[model samples]
Target: MHDGIVVYPTDTLYGLGGDALSDEAIMKVFEAKGREYHKPISIAVSDPDMIRAVACVDELAEEFIDQFLPGPVTVILPARTILSSWLTAGTKKIGIRYPNHEIALELISRFDSPITATSANLSGGPDPVSLDLCTVPYDCAINAGPLSGIPSTVVDLELREIIRAGAEIDAVAAFLAQWS
Candidate 1:
């Protein structure tokens, strides 16, 4: 398994990453970004079963996963057995993303477990969208050139609400509306 926090391109921006299961690795991401523990860190899972293993899955979640995942969207759901408080702060919910980029998938595949997917910047700084403007502010950067420059849409499954609208809102909205 890969050790230490890594930097990489993501759909939203460059991401600072680490093993989702390792408390030390997780701490590195927070430290590298000067991020707070109060805000939950998002995790990236390449396999559907892996995601199902960590986050409580419902029919709606499955539907959304089948449709918008491997794209620009993060689905926030109730945390499951494998997810630790390190990833979710003290909350019982976790945010997950299955990015569309091949490089992202390859990195996740290599890590075996889910990896943290926080924007590759300090907590209150501007996110780097292109490699020219990107800086490796973490332990390592799993380079994949510039990213798509669009942040993922964030959907809250517990509240059944769209927290942030991005490029995939229309598609995401239709998928959620079906449940309501």
Candidate 2:
């Protein structure tokens, strides 16, 4: 986020990113995208270990992540002590991902906290797959060429089940199946 705001293509869509732990920066994302405060956002980290720093990651979740991360998968887990209520929407849990893109990985590494991965589009709109088609109302956009074009598979580790199907399932499924 050269302009002090970061935007990048995620597994699901182009995401308007910012300091995950910053209330002000997070507020800006909500204002810029016109997103509702009630709906919590997801965060992306460069490594699975980073997930533990932000949330209370369990052994099972770690196992799944060891196999599925650095790819299309968003794991929902309990938030750690420091997450803002704004990020969790009053819930005790948070959604996290490690996108399979070098640029995204680098951004998360640089930011040093889980970065928000909410779609760049306004609420209830199609995700932008290309810069030409991107319509996010933001001051900066970190275009990493075309996206992988497939959304990350969303799995609720809280309940140990898959909530939304996306591009990479076999990989995630195989990981989760090991838990059973």
Candidate 3:
């Protein structure tokens, strides 16, 4: 991401992202994908601490996160850190992930900051499973074979609603219900 945006493999699909903390880098990802800055982008974090650094997780949100993360799920939480509106896209919430893929997690673990976690594809285009299918301009790409093409399940825990039922929604709700 230092050089520019990179297309990396995640548990769900290939994602186009850069330094999540760098507004300039984030903008480059936006430009590369022809994406508007007003659209919020998700982030890939390395660990629980990393998740806490960027988002404010309440007790209810924490239960779902503790039970269903490091898997194929994108949990949207209130933004706690002061990041550019470009990252959160004017919304007070940020979608966060801790992808189960080792490569994805290691990249963020080493970088010591979140990385953009939006799918690697053109704006309004289908999500790419293979690096070869990506149309965005990226400085680097790490391919790990083909993905299932099913995006992660997206949940807005603050609202206790399922935004996108990609993977493991019922279990997530059931788990959260335990604490609810």
- On TM-score, the leading prediction is 3
* Candidate 2 residue-wise lDDT at 78: 96
Alpha-carbon lDDT, every model: 0.82, 0.79, 0.86
CA lDDT for candidate 1: 0.82
Output the lDDT of residue 148, model 3: 76
Off by over 4 Å in 2: 1-4, 178-180
For candidate 2, give the lDDT of residue 121.
74
Tens-place lDDT digits, model 3, residues 71-101? 9999999997566678888888999989999
TM-score of each: 0.93, 0.90, 0.94
Between which residue pairs do clashes occur in model 2?
none
Q: Against the true structure, what is every candidate's RMSD?
A: 1.6, 2.0, 1.4
Query: Lowest-scoring 10 consecutive residues by lDDT in candidate 2?
Result: 1-10
Residue 143: error of model 3 in Å?
1.2
lDDT of 2 by residue, 1-180 (tens): 532456787765677788888888788888877889998888888997888888888788877777778777888999997888898999888999888877888878887777788777777767678776566577677776677667778898878788888877876677678776
Better of 1 and 3 by TM-score: 3
